[model samples]
Target chain A: MQRILNVFVKYRNSILYLFLLGFSLIFLKANSNFHQLKLEKISLFFSSSLYSFSNSINRYFRLEKENQRLLKENEVLKSIQIRSNTLFLYTEGCNNKTNFPFDVQRVNIIKNSFQSQYNYIIIDKGAASGIKREMGVISAKGIIGLVQAVTDNYASVISILNQDMKINVRFKNRTTFGSLIWKGKNPKKFSIEDVVSTSSIKKGDTIVTGGMSSYFPYGIPLGVVTNLENNIQNGYYKIDAELFENPAELYKAYVIENSDFKEINSLMQNIKQ
Target chain B: MNSQILKMMGSFVLLILAQVLLFNQINIFGSVNPMLYLLFLVMYPFDQNQTFYIFIGFLLGFFIDFISQTGGAHTIASLSVSYLRPIIMKYSYGLTSERPKSILTDPRKTNNFVFLLIFISVHHLIYFSIAYFSADAFLLIIKNSLLTMIFSLILILLISSLYRVK
Candidate 1:
């Protein structure tokens, strides 16, 4: 026993380091997939508070940019409202009527990270504000991401810049659709996969959401194609596109809710079963 | 003793704040993220208890990881660096009865530069390796670590020079 004590005393620092390193490694390994997701939730509680405090101070410095963005969004909303009102008037006289399928809720991004492979953005709205998992999130200029998880008062979004996130998009005015994915490097650029070599694609062509999924409506602007490469072996084009929204500077976003989402999902599930 | 503890506490708060608020937001050259918080471990007094430094390193790193959602990459890197600090100091400055008071306050600029280089490089190496943690990302890990280490070394040197420790 005494010999063991002497050994312990002799290498106490190494033992301590090994113990602490083991502990951290355990944490690193344990925080895989679900546990990592849960860890993010717990960490979000602390990060959100810290970010909120910092954002209060930081928000003032970006007031000019914020004001300009809000003004432009307001203008877009106003134009949409005017067009929809005219449509509503025209449809009122017709027997068959069309209605907008998605509802938008404005929320503030409490914390944002774009440097990591699995980037996440936490917003101030959650279940209380009708924000739910899988709801699409959009900034003023374009699509941001989709809600991954939700707490009582906060929702975490998987940013389009994340490697794991794949958004379905297509060239504006073209029928060919491709999957947009981040290459885990640039915050502003994403690559479009599965676009055929024969597709009518060009540099400076606009990319927009396909709206094949319930998350986003068709025609929401995503970005512009910046580069294109032909993969003769795969018969697919590797197209690079620049995002419209500067995610690092994004503060306000709109959470989109598809009213028919539940009905459509249940029907699809039934068909699969 | 009380003043020393107080100074360390102040440094802990200041470094963490600067890391989370300022450096975290700055992504120079797309991938080079300067982890200036490692400066705390770099500037830690060498004469302090080795075990205590390890614990402090763990606590400091864990706190940053919790905030940044990086799991325990920082904790592992910080603890390893802190544990190896004594050996690093011994090699850089040679054995002596009294350790150098501060890395920045080292009169020999070359020694200080060497110490900073090894310290930041090791930290970044461990940090980026764990962060990427994949066979395919080995090249990415090395690229990120080297790029970040260079920038971090420059920033740490600049900050330490401006900071005069009495």
Candidate 2:
């Protein structure tokens, strides 16, 4: 008995080590089967929660870029809506006619030049898609330009940012009309020339296209009044407006064809004769 | 004595956090994940009781297995290494069982390097073998163990050089 006790005391640490190691091996063998599935479930719960928490943080940083992408997608949908002729046909008492006076064809801008004074845009549609010269072009946000030239498969547009381009515009209330023209300076801004000084235009009035010409219909948005300067000597208001359409970022456009353009021109030629 | 115990407890928590949050997610060369949690076992004071070392190893391994879903592989491997660590130290550093502190603080870099290499290789061998327990996966086990051992050794040496215990 005494010898056994002495040996036990002398090698207690080694005994403990061996005992625990054997216990661990047995535990491993026992839990190697179905219990592993349970363990995996528990671990998945923890790791997935941690991953979602980190993912939420990552998503917050990308919200602005996501918003821009959504806006672009919305523009594409709006262009499709215009091409199907369902957008403007909702006006009261205008449901009987299936074909409206104007037809819109959606086209993608293949090439755009905004830095030069005489900016021009090339679109993917041409005479093959019924596109021709003197047709109005507009983006989802506002008016872009007019179709200046066309080939069998493509059309070049006289951009609204060009110095030679001008379009008739009116205030939102239809109180006064003016000519919208770019000043060869800022691409994002254009000046409404020939507005009489007696006009009641404010700093933030909404401007839209005037239907005086046969190209564009009434009430297509153009821009807003950013600055208004009254030239007392010239008796006109040098109205500066900020454009809604960004020329450099114009990806899609709608080509508006006035179906009665030839009839209206021929009637005016007969009157002149 | 109390401060040393507190420091050990702090190291225990830190090692587990680092293993779960960082090291487990990192896969170098598409296969090698440096097992940095083993540093706690390697850097534990050698002058402590052997039985206590084994108990700590089991606890640490069990906790890591619970978090990483490794199902007793870590526990078995860690316990084996902790139990046989004294013998390895004796063989690698020419030290006896009575003077264990000299092995850690010793100035000879080669002896320390050899000791760490042997210890980590043995741990990784047992770990990979148990984790991938299949006859067809023999080459896979060896390849994974050897690659992990290399990366773990580099990381352990770098961490030790930065923060010397003594």
Candidate 3:
């Protein structure tokens, strides 16, 4: 008993260090598995006081750029409005009149981060504003991210820049599709994988969000293909693209809620089962 | 000594607030966001209780991790670096009783600069490695750590020099 006590006393520092190290590693694992409930709420609380305040101060400095972006978005929206007004939705399968399932809510990003592997952005709107998980977010230029977690008054989005987020995207004007993922290498670039080699792809091809998952509506621009390499072993093309809306420059985004998301998700799950 | 603990606690909160609010926003070259929160551990007094320092180091990094939502990468990196600081200081100052009061206040000592660089690099490497957390991104970890370390080293050194007026 005396010898054991002396051993523990001598190595007490190392013992404590290891204990804390284990505690942190456990936290790391919990967070990685997306099981962070209490910590996430605490983060949301901090976001309101800490991030939002700084964001407001920073907003004044970027007024000129923000105005320009809004103007560009306005132009895009106006054109879309004109086209929609001129056209009509007529489908043979469904007799019900088209009520767009997607709801677009404009929200300000309190904090945008792309430095880490799994980056998340905090938006000002949350449960009070009808923001919920699995809702897709997009900027004026392209798809931004998906809402992964929500708290009252704030929602954390898993940005497209995150390594864990693989967005389903297809080449413009073509059915060829690939899953877009970030390599944690560069913020401006994304890699498209699992593209069959037979798909005719070229540099500068436009990549847009695929509506298969019902996350983003069909045809939201994502990026333009910049490079392509044939993965001979997998017989697929490893493609890279430069994003349209650079996340770092982004200040505002629209949180889109799909009214039929749960319905569609349940149907898909039922089919799988 | 009592006042010192109070100052440490005060600066602990202040530094983390500055980190999440101020430093985290600056994305130099689009990828290298300097982790200025590391200043606390780097400047911690060598005479303080080693065990306490190590534990607080974990909390210091854990707070950053919580704010930034990077899991425990910051916690692990910060904890390890604080644990290794004594050994690092041993080599950095060559067991001199007169460890420079401040890394930059005693600017003539080239060892101070080396110490700062090593500290930042090790922390950044461990940070990027854990944050990336995949053998697939080994090269990315190195590139990110190097770029971020350079910027972090510069930012901390620049901020510390403000106190070098004495």
Every candidate's lDDT: 0.82, 0.81, 0.81
lDDT tens digits by residue: candidate 1, B1-166: 8997898899999998888888988989876779999888988877678888889999999888878777688888888888888887777777763578878676877777888888888888888877866567899988899999988988888887777644
Where model 1 places Cα greater than 4 Å from the true spot, the runs are: A34-273, B95-98
DockQ winner between candidates 1 and 3? 1
Candidate 2 lDDT over B91-110, as tens digits, reads 77786424447334667778
Judged by lDDT relative to the true structure, which candidate is superior, 1 or 3?
Answer: 1
Model 2 RMSD in angstroms = 17.7
Candidate 2: misplaced stretches above 4 Å?
Answer: A1-76, A79-90, A93-102, A114-117, A248-251, A260-273, B1-166
Give each prediction's root-mean-square deviation over alpha carbons.
26.1, 17.7, 27.5
After superposition of all CA atoms, the RMSD between model 1 and the true structure is 26.1
Q: What DockQ does every candidate get?
A: 0.30, 0.23, 0.26
Tell me how many residue pairs clash in candidate 3. 0
TM-score of chain A of each: 0.67, 0.68, 0.67
Clashing pairs in 2: none
Model 3 per-residue lDDT at A30: 88
Give the per-prediction TM-score of chain B. Answer: 0.92, 0.92, 0.90
